[model samples]
Target: MADLVSERASEAKEITRRTALERGAGVAAVGAASALAAALSSSSAAAAVPGAKAQDTSSHSRGTTLPTVVAGVRIPDSQLTRAVTEFARKVSSESLFNHVMRTYLYGSLMFDRRGIRYDREFAFVAAVLHDLGLVKAYQTPNERFEVDGADAARNFLRGRHMPAERVEVVWDAIALHTNVGIASRKRPEIGMVSAGSGLDLTGNGLQQIPADALTEILAAFPRAGFTQDALDTILSLCRTKPMSVLMHPFAEVGRRHLSDFQVPTVEDLLLAAPFEE
Candidate 1:
């Protein structure tokens, strides 16, 4: 018994140590990206057209048009957008961050192909932050990972003083991104977020994008072992927070990857109720 206890303690220490290292790496990457963005913003301002229409000069505006357009999709370039990107970088592993970026770009391409009108910035924000629950910084012990991510995104936007209605849209987009039928029936932005992420994870809508555009998108954000990394992250969450995965599909991940996973199934809960019926 004493040997078993010591082994468990050692395992716990290792998990904590690895988590700390991952977070440290994320922060370092964020810092480098921020410095590069600032330098590029300054250079763009210096080379601006002499008499172009004045851009929004608010704190949210970057005041320069450094080319953020990638693969015919224009990624919004503003102070607020940069902040959103930087925050994701700080909280997410590189593979996960790249996955979110691909999610946005893939969704944007689909929107363009279908001639669907939507708010680009809102969609981008929702897409990038959709997996926040999977990251250590935004995870909660009890909520479904989707809800945790949505709540985190909502709080972040509200802290920025975004309007309630707009914030709600983003919340729905993130929260329902995994709910296939329901999400697709909601507002356009919500549907796009779900569809985009679904495409990246499962190739559900690969036929919607042309081969050339897909090539370009992948080139910009290489998968970089995203599939295995994502699986490990999910399995980690399942191990640490079994309750959070109880009613969600993540329960299956726990069952498959975790030898000790014993969370009750929906049917188990239903049949085990105290009622005499």
Candidate 2:
């Protein structure tokens, strides 16, 4: 009896570990697997997951596999569209825009953390719009934007019939998702999935940025116009944010559905991590 209790206690201690790295792997893998199963099980069920509406799956080009969208629910609410439009208008500059884009892209592919249905949907939508404050702060990298952005998102969500509690998840994911290195009491699936895949969204830790001989993509194609501006903006952003490499992985995986657009980046294949030794 004592031996069994000791064995159980040992297992309990091991399970009780709050190691940040372990948390990252567990949350990411579990979230990814759960989404995959849902995608296979039912499209409507899959559609219920949070942040499930990102059009950018190109970030999954890294070794990670993205689940298929079963239910195919695109976030088409008019209120959500207005909110997203407002946020998009606020974004400018290559670096900041790419960071927001990649965060949504890779965060969706990697984590898609969904806890409660309404909150999950609302928070994910908020994540998509989290960086609008940057437009107000082109002069200063003020921390105030974090608070402001969260507030803006909360108002938009609450106005959309999203409950108040769910608004906080949106607030928190928008506010804290960037700090992937520091341990958090609660980790967002979006951050863990992006970080666990080593895709690097915030550009916080890295030794080298991924390479992009995106020459094939930079030029205008005969069939469709070249996205020179988008490509240029992305490249410019790449110089600064190493996690932007997640773009590479995204493009490769989400090809046909995302063609003509230069693949986001096949970042998962890169050998060097941007983290400095």
Root-mean-square deviation per candidate: 12.8, 18.4
Q: Per-residue lDDT for 1-277 in model 1, tens only?
A: 3444444334333445533332221222111111010111111111011222222221322323324877889999776677787666555555666678888888899988999999898888888878766655555665656666777788777777789999899987877777656667888888888778878877777899889888988887777765666566667767887765554666676888788887765556555544696
Candidate 1, residue 154: the lDDT equals 81
Residue 9 C-alpha lDDT in model 1: 38
Which parts of model 1 are misplaced by more than 4 Å? Answer: 1-67
Task: Report clashes for each candidate as comma-separated counts.
Answer: 0, 22
Each prediction's whole-model lDDT (CA): 0.64, 0.34
Maximum-TM-score candidate:
1
Provide TM-scores for the models: 0.74, 0.37
Q: Local error of candidate 1 at 151, Å? A: 1.7
Candidate 2, residue 83: lDDT: 49
